[model samples]
Target: MSEEILINSTPNETRVAMVENGMLQEVLIERNRKSSIVGNIYIGRVEKILPGLQAAFVNIGQSRAAFMHVTDVCSQEKLIRLEGQQAATQSDVSLPPISKMIHEGQRIIVQVYKDAIGSKGARVTCKLSIPSRFLVLLPDEPNVQTLSIR
Candidate 1:
């Protein structure tokens, strides 16, 4: 089996393709003007809280406010600490409400996991993870984890 990656870049657009045994496997295209923000991090302000939806709208300096859920705000694996605030006290049982976790006009760190659609805003999470060549770095996390590639 043979695999090859092809990348084509121009002024406005960039294209990437993966081929395996002369068969096209995947293709990705990105625009310079409208680039994807799937893995970007930002220090955003909490704009609004929707207790009914268990979500909050965060202003990440984008045109549209990003949406975040309670689960994202309180992750059992990673605890999210607000800017200049102490870490949240959580248990293994359950999570608290979004309103209790965050309030309006509060600054928090978030990472974009989904791009903005036509009407919906971008999806963000407080559980931030940065992947590198050999390990995944978790900010504000005390434990260090390494990647295993088998």
Candidate 2:
């Protein structure tokens, strides 16, 4: 089944419906004001690096800076390259040292994976995913596997 986004707007509110075939599968209502911030890409500057937490805070021109991890920094190819570079690097692929990967004042492109909840900042990732009706496209990944949909 193919899916499409149908946006309906009123003076007070805007409703977005995800339609599959001829029926509405999901409905998202935004009151002229509020919306979710997930999947937003921003060109951000690294504010601070916390080696203890294995993460970094990035200024994405928001009220709060986004958080990115070292594991999230390297692409799949980069991980493979690192593994091929040295035998010792293979074990560190999953949880790489953040300090060695990123530094303060570095500019990076980050996408919000999760929204800021309470006092915590947005969880960000360098990996970006584009979703389609039938498939999801990961630009950086080389291998493509077909998935069976039921």
Candidate 3:
């Protein structure tokens, strides 16, 4: 099976639809004013750490701070590396508590994997990944497995 892409562009917005066997498989839209921030990198200051939620909110120069859970803290075996069109998943990996791992006022490098939806902020991960046309560059992977291809 082969896929085709149809793009509809205008001054204010652009819509891209992927068609497989003439059936719409996926649709992505980018508005001029509101573009997606997924896959974007940011150096942010940890504004607050919630031990109860096992998460931290970092001010990444966005309207709302991004959210990161303890599991997304980038462990050796639990890291997610997506190449091509692969989806991310989580596995069992033990690590220290979020409170002990990250402190308030600490600066961390994070990558936004999800965009802000409704009233919630974007979700980020410390395991930085840069996706290109065919590869997802895992710059933060352990030195041994530095670069990962799908």
Candidate 4:
């Protein structure tokens, strides 16, 4: 696999484009006013916990509370196949209940996985992952490699 990076800088903004195999993949933009916060780690307080949905809402100094699902809270031992690749998707592996994992008003570190859309807040995960130039690394998935060189 091969990749190329294109960066454009101006006085007001800086844009970084990543092209893989001559195809446009991702573009990151940073403006003078606001910077992109996706993939940023934050020490946040757990705002609310919903036992019914097995999820929680956390305040990470964002406009809206980010979401934390049960699967993201607990580490899974079993591995499942995703639509695209054999990455570890959450399975019915009998993980501990969310209530046992965390509580409201508690503080924990979380990472933003998805950006906030329209009226919805961002999606966060306790299991953080930072991508490198040629590798998509998951902390828990040490033995799993999602990409292959052609």
Top lDDT: which candidate number?
1
Task: Output the better candidate (2/4) by lDDT.
Answer: 2
lDDT by residue (20-127, candidate 2, tens digit) is 898877677877655668888889999999888888999998888888877788674667676565435456446458887878999988889999988888989988
TM-score of each: 0.69, 0.72, 0.66, 0.64
- Candidate 4 structure lDDT: 0.81
- Descending-TM-score candidate ranking: 2, 1, 3, 4
Model 3 score (lDDT): 0.81
The best-first sequence of candidates by lDDT reads 1, 2, 3, 4
Which candidate comes out best when scored by TM-score?
2
TM-score, cand. 2 vs. native: 0.72
**How far in Å is the alpha carbon of 36 misplaced in model 2?**
1.0
lDDT of 1: 0.85
Please provide, for model 4 over 40-120, each residue's C-alpha lDDT reduced to its tens digit, 9 standing for 90 to 100: 989989999999999999999999999999988745642232223344444544556688889999999899988888888
Candidate 3 per-residue C-alpha lDDT over 1-120 given as tens digits, one digit per residue, 9 for 90 to 100: 989999999999999999989877777888898678998989999999999999999999999999999988776454333222233433333456799888999999999999999889
Return the clash pairs for model 2, or none. Answer: none
lDDT of 3 at 110: 93
What lDDT does each candidate get? Answer: 0.85, 0.82, 0.81, 0.81
